[model samples]
Target: MAKIEPGNGLKSAESRKSLRGTTESLALTDGEGNLFGSDSELNVYTSERQTDKYGFIGGAQQYSEQSAENIPPEVLRQREAKWLDMLNNWDKWMAKRHKKMKLRCQKGIPPSLRGRAWLYLSGGKVKREQHKGKFEELDSQAGDPKWVDVIERDLHRQFPFHEMFVARGGHGQQDLYRVLKAYTLHRPEEGYCQAQAPIAAVLLMHMPAEDAFWGLVQICEKYLPGYYSAGLEAIQLDGEILFTLLKRVSPLAHRHLKKHKLDPILYMTEWFMCAFSRTLPWVSVLRVWDMFLCEGVKIIFRVGLVLLKCMLGSQDKLKTCQGQYETMELLKTIDTRYMQEGFLVREILELPVSERDIEKEHLASVRRWKETRGELHCKSLPRMHGAKAIMAAEPPSRQDLRQNPTIIVESPLATKSNGEDKERKNTKEQKNGKKNSSPTPVAAYLEPSEPSPLLKDAALLGSNQSLSSAEYDTYL
Candidate 1:
């Protein structure tokens, strides 16, 4: 047989080539390296017998190549549409992503995009880096000495003050301070608000200083307007707003509150001032913040309503403890479970939409108040943001305070006794970290049935009465 050439061909041809080539190679070998060359009758007959034997492997490769080249048209079309949609409508997608990022401030945004996403969503994303440099440059030459002093004073008092806050930081206080100082440098206008400190600390857990500063700016300017204001009116307005919402939703609770002379403002002031950081468990506050970012400031009312409603409804068989201090200890111990069940987290979750309704109702109510009080309502009063004028003039008697469900304003006569004494005592204890013999059991005295009559009536008392820290400070 003639020698065969090796080349890319089907199996039948290759097999023939193999046989001829075998013979040639055998002929060239030495005796020691023996090779089989003699072809028997079965060889030539069988070689010619199977021409199509190799077709299967060739067919498989061809089919595979064809499938790769010609991917299904619909799948390709769908993928192209998705890519085009992403390209054309990227901003919309980005906005939704940014909103999600804001809500997850506790977990922090991804480290890589943290700065960009924060600034962009706040409408500063594009200029965040540039603005940071500019602010730093300005801060070196332009920050006020007074602002720096104020910022320094407040830096440590911000986050992790309670055990609730301390649990959040794996990093020591030093890292938290550096981020806070850097932020104070970045946004000098805000300088450093009280609530910003805690919020910034939380942001630092997940972001760099610059991003945290801008995030603080967004919080102050966009989410909480009053917090940044010189007078701190936003918190006051919110307190007034919470009072109004409670009255509308739970009138029975409102009456009980009025009778006892308990001021919703007293307890909730801390809540609004601190954004619930000091009020609820730290994690619960973060959960509220998640909704806050998406929904805005009105979540404050939802939280307040839920809390007040919880306190009111659950006091049915509440056992009385000892004096005011014991009463307060008992009040503080009320479990949150029942309160949570009735006030739907899902409903609260939907409050960004609910807030629109609240804002509209709020605006209308303001208009109605003005219309009804036309001549008596002075320009200064509406702007004053005082709770006294908004509430009823007289405080409830100890008995009236018990029967009414609404929280009441205290009357002038009720505080003739030593109500301010308890306030002073508590203030001293708070300052010294010593438990005073006399507890200003405001929480205990604020019986769900008996609204703190002193609070409702206190509005009518002369200006000579002593004030709490929150009273003169105005923000809380």
Candidate 2:
């Protein structure tokens, strides 16, 4: 993992000197005559300047070495061809061959095509078209001063080894700043969250500043609304839903976690919020993003289940952990070999769970949440600038909000008033007049349906299977 030097391929010293002079001229120097703005300003330089300074040569070489390795040239050409065809007639492809599109995504999108593919899948292109110059407008406007310092602190830490973001005032870091700052302005109530920095940085890797900004908007407002907000109520509710799913699908692991008092938020917050960017390997992270954009938030739950099955499915494996700290540590740094993107994704597709199942549980979880925490107060916006505008224009019904089937459904519980028919269940433990011995009544949620019959006999059975010899030998 050697650091790629700033100007590796420049053969002549004079040419390198000329490039350096151009970069220095384009850069905004500080009062002390230092190149680029002060750390607090998050000054952005031209991508041309960054390309010269950081040696981000074009095409596959621009990607990380690990990402570029082992990809075949023919495969690259084929993927690019498909991307071109889809881009030219997107509506036709989407309407006629959406299943084929999903299958291709599951195989993994080519790095070169990933940016365009993401825009198409997440509808960022349409968003970008709607708000033609919104990013530039937002970039020029002053963002909330409070968020500037926080955004600056996270810039360098995002992808220090990647050539695009390695330099102090590189294009990648600058675009990341613009996208985040625009988002803070777009939804002032949400402000800035540290989790969003990594997600935005990843987006900047694949697209230009404006495209990246719109993609970030789609992710925040559509893919996972209220996820990066101050209260983080949506993610909190999802954590509870994940726990509920675990109880039915992997009772033994669920009980073990309950016994040790391990909360899902402790480990799952990063996984769900960052979309596994910080947790999974680089290749796996890209693969997950491909499916995630096409399928929406359910991919997240499926991936979480796969990781849990790999880490905690076996009783013997759980027995080795001494305490909550040890279990958390193991989960955080689990063997990546077992969690290879292709195999884990296949397992996810095979799982019996569906969007319908997740929606039902989400509705049930929200009901329980209301009972215990009073009412949820989610912020609402008049209209999001891009892909989320459709959702913002027409307020969703109570059932639609609770179901939250697609990315179009932002702020599931965004409205102020709960319907008159909705009733909060009594969640308090019933007193049996025994000394703390009465069993608490768990919320009455439906039992998870049996997994696909093929999965029932497989080694990995819906997050609760005995460790196979191969898995144990490789991962344990």
Scanning candidate 1 in windows of ten residues, the lowest lDDT window is 53-62
Over 1-476, each residue of candidate 2 has an lDDT whose tens digit, in order, gives: 01112322122344322211122222433223555444344323333333421133222123344332356889877876786566555665665777787788887876656776787677666677666678888999988878876777677766554556657777778778888889898878778877788888877777667778888887887778777765566776788888888776677778777777776766677799888876775667778899888777778888887777777888887877758777777887776555665577778787677667777888897899789878887753321222223333433333332211111111223211222113121222224333434433322222111112232222321232232211221112
How high a TM-score does candidate 2 get? 0.66
For candidate 2, what is the total of clashing residue pairs?
0
Please, what are the lDDT tens digits per residue for candidate 1 over residues 204-240? Answer: 5444444456666556555565444443334434555
Error of 2 at 155 (Å): 1.2
Residue ranges of candidate 1 with Cα displaced over 4 Å: 1-90, 94-132, 138-142, 161-191, 314-344, 350-353, 364-476
What lDDT score belongs to each candidate, Candidate 1 first? Answer: 0.43, 0.63
10 residues in a row with least lDDT, candidate 2: 403-412
Each candidate structure's TM-score, on Cα atoms with residue i matched to residue i, is: 0.47, 0.66
**Total residue pair clashes for candidate 1:** 44
Q: Which candidate has the highest lDDT of all?
A: 2
